[model samples]
Target: MNDQVELVAQAIYEAEHGVCLWEGEPARHKERFREYARNAIELLDEDIGVLLLALQEANAGARLRRSKGSVRRDPN
Candidate 1:
């Protein structure tokens, strides 16, 4: 991947893995990811193609990437 893609993925990994101060600490980053994922799904559904298909594709792609041990680095 290009530099921009790598950077964006690094940013996402940082966001998903937030800071923790102590043992058994609650992760505050998941909430942000959930919120952002929801908003993205909503906005894309409204402006792009069908929601169901988008969600299906997202799920399938996620599964494939995970199974292949390949992290998705966006070109954003």
Candidate 2:
């Protein structure tokens, strides 16, 4: 869809499969995963906000078109 949406989706995919450099240490790996998880959550939240705003704008435009009689309805 939108460029920003695509970027966010890619970021999410990367985050889910991210690898830690300290691969041999269990504690370090867990810590790195936790950090990545937090960042992913924030990014997801921001993306959701953007999508919601887009939805609202689209709805408003549709409503305006309907009020102006530019959008037509089916007789069936």
Q: Write the per-residue lDDT of candidate 1 for residues 8-58, one digit (tens) a residue.
A: 333344455663222343456444444555555555565534644544475
Sliding window of 10 residues with minimal summed lDDT for model 2: 1-10
lDDT of 2 at 65: 72
Any idea what lDDT model 2 has?
0.52
TM-score of each: 0.31, 0.33
Provide the overall lDDT of each model, using Cα atoms, as 2-decimal numbers.
Answer: 0.46, 0.52
**Angstrom error at residue 39, model 1:** 0.4
Tell how far residue 38 is off in model 1, in angstroms: 0.5
Residue pairs with clashing backbones, model 2: none
Clashing pairs in 1: none
Error of 1 at 66 (Å): 7.9
Quote model 1's TM-score.
0.31
